[model samples]
Target: MWDERVPVHVAGDFYDLDAFRTRPDVLRDFETAEVGDVTGRTLLHLQCHIGTDTLSWAHRGAARVVGLDFSAPAVEAARALAAGLGHGPERAAFVTGDVYDAAQSVPEASYDIVYTGLGALCWLPDIRRWAETAASLVAPGGFLYLAEFHPVTESLDDATGTRIVRDYFARDAQVWDEPGTYADPDAETVHNRSVQWQHTLGDVVSALAATGLHIEFLHEHDVSVFPRFENFEVRGGYHRFPDGHPRIPLIYSLKATKG
Candidate 1:
């Protein structure tokens, strides 16, 4: 599913590589502040779609950055992008593999920061395994940083406008057969049928804690990097609900350190 969406994203406004070529620091503002002082950090980005965020980290002063993805096309594109940006393979490298499987593929306990998710966790079925992989990748004193769509926010029915419809604590992967990619809703579609899971806020926190990662802070916000529902307003270079809409936590961020 992700493989087919690569070209669409590459050409779309969401992952604008043309703009990226001119501007190396295209990371979202909050992300820049949260993943602070990457000056000499070895950062690893898992489920990294096409390495924009990975390269963004590299540009922010990460000494070494690796982007891991399940899609071969995305990895190839990411490598090309990093090379084009002149970071090349020395500073920025991309690997094609499932995030869960990359624990063995990438040198374990090597990275200073393990990063994942803007819209990543939903695609995975096991938070337990995800936490373990993140924990294993970061060295002692290093941390796992994540910013994701809130499960509560995701559970609402956007198809018929915002309303509670889906299970917030669903234990199984939900099947989606919708056409079109998120980047281009009108484009010709491929691999429309995909599976996604829902993880509650509690589940996410517990999974990392169980892996022995100490929670630094868990912050929630009403804005997101993309419009997740109908009629959401774009503000501060992100998306949020208008003043009168039902207020809910649309995004959540957490930084957990490995002891």
Candidate 2:
């Protein structure tokens, strides 16, 4: 499903390829601010679809960067995009592989930063395994940074776009087959079958801690990088709930150190 939606996203208004070509800082403002100073650091991006944010790190002067994704098409496109950025494999590279298998596929404890998640964690089947792999990937003295859509915000109503309809602490994965793509909602109908798990803030924090990664900070913000829900107004450069509506956090960022 992701592979099929790649072209739709690359050519859609959501990604804005033209704007990205000129302004290379494709990551959100908070993400850039939180994961500061990537210069001279070896960074690894997991589930990096199309490598926009991965190459954005390169733009910030990362010494070397590797972006791994399960989609072969996305990885292929990322390689092309990196080439266009005037950086070869030595400085930047994209690999096709499942994020859960990254520990075995890539060199462990070799990256100064292990960056992952941005509407990516829900697709993962197990947060514990994900945390363990992330901990293993981060080199000693390095850290793992995650900026993800807040599960709290998502547990609210989606189908009706009103009221909290789903369980906040549901341990099971929900199956979805929505035809419209988030990037291009009007695109041709495509098979979009997938399973997503519901993970609370505690699940995320506990997983990281169990892997021995000391949590440096966990911050939640009302701003969101994506239009994950309905009834949002763009304010302060983020899609947020309306002015009168009860303001709630839409995104959460975590910084955990590999001690």
Candidate 3:
């Protein structure tokens, strides 16, 4: 499914590769501030689609950045984009592999910062295994940082997000058969079936804690990266509910350090 969507996403206006080429900072202001400076750090980005966020870290002066994804086409796109941005293989590398096998798949054994970007966790079935695998790649004294859409939204109505229509603690996998990608909703395409699982904020934190990672912070925000709810308005590069509308945690970020 992800393999077929790579081309569409790369050419779509949602990503805007042309704009990114000129100004390659796609990261949110709060995310950069939360992750702090990466002047000389070695970072690894898991589930890195097209390497935009991965290369963004390199743009921020990270000594080395590597991106790993399950889709081969996405990896190729990322490598091409990195080269186009004047980043060499040594400075920014991309690998094609699964997130569960990331430790063995990546060129480096470990990194100073192990990052999992937004919309990544939902694709994984086992949060515990993900934490264990991701935590293993974090060098001692290093940390694993994840920014994801809040699971609470899954329980709310898709349109208005005002009422709950699903179980909040449901452990079953939710399958989606919708056509078109999030980048281009009107686009015509196949391979639309997707299986996803919801992991609550508690599930994510506890899973990392089970791997002996110290939870540094778990911060929730009212804004989202995409227009999750119909009532959401674009504000300062983020989506939020309009005035008089109730606010909910649309996204969250967590940083866990290995002892």
Candidate 4:
């Protein structure tokens, strides 16, 4: 899924690689501030599509950063990008593997931070397994920080207009068979196989808690990286309705620490 979208995303203006490089800390002011300083920490980024956020951590003075993704092409691209930036393979590295198998691939209790960036968790089918892998990878007292799209945003019909067509708590898999890419709707594609699962706020919190990771904080933000639903207005950094809009969470960030 990510392999097909990587090139498209890199070429698309949505990622804005130039802007990211010019302003390395694009996510500095966001919810990640709760994670505090990462300098001298060993961080592991899961489902890192092209490793922009992973590279950002390296730029933030992390001692070592490893970006893991299922897409081999994306891993290669991320390594290439890191090398081009003069970081080489020492500061950062990219690996290709499934999130569930990450525990077997990465040493247990080796990382100080297990991080997953925006728009990452929805791709996983099992949140329990995901949480377990994250908890297993984190060293004692280490943290797991996830900044993801709010489950409420997934309930609306983003394809056509701002309409609540799906249940917010629905655990069923929502199949998307669209041909055009999210970045470029007009671009032709060779493969369009994509599957996503919608998880609620409770689902995320409970999953992490079940893994024996204590929750530190969970915050909901009105703003998101993209305007998910049609007819939503972009105000400041948030996408919201004009007024009298339904009260719903648009984005959420969670921080948990291992005991």
Which of the numbered candidates is closest to the native, going by highest TM-score?
A: 3
Candidate 3: list runs displaced more than 4 Å: none
How do the predictions measure up, each by TM-score? Answer: 0.94, 0.95, 0.98, 0.91
Show pairs that collide, candidate 2: none
RMSD of 3: 0.9
lDDT of 1 at 69: 92
Please report, in order, the local distance difference test score of every candidate based on alpha carbons: 0.85, 0.86, 0.93, 0.81
Candidate 2 vs. true structure, TM-score: 0.95
TM-score of 4: 0.91
Clashes of each: 0, 0, 0, 1
Give per-residue CA lDDT, model 1, range 18-50, as digits (tens).
998888776767767887899988999998888
Worst 10 residues of 3 by lDDT: 230-239
Stretches of candidate 1 exceeding 4 Å from the true structure: 159-162, 244-246
Q: Where's the lowest-lDDT run of ten residues in candidate 2?
A: 153-162
Preferred candidate (TM-score higher): 3 or 4:
3
- In candidate 3, position 38 carries an lDDT of 96
- Candidate 3 residues 162-218, lDDT tens each? 999999898898999988999998888889899999888889899999999999999
**Ranking according to lDDT, highest score first:** 3, 2, 1, 4
The sequence of per-residue lDDT tens digits that candidate 2 reaches over residues 119-161 is 8999988999999888889999999999998888766885324
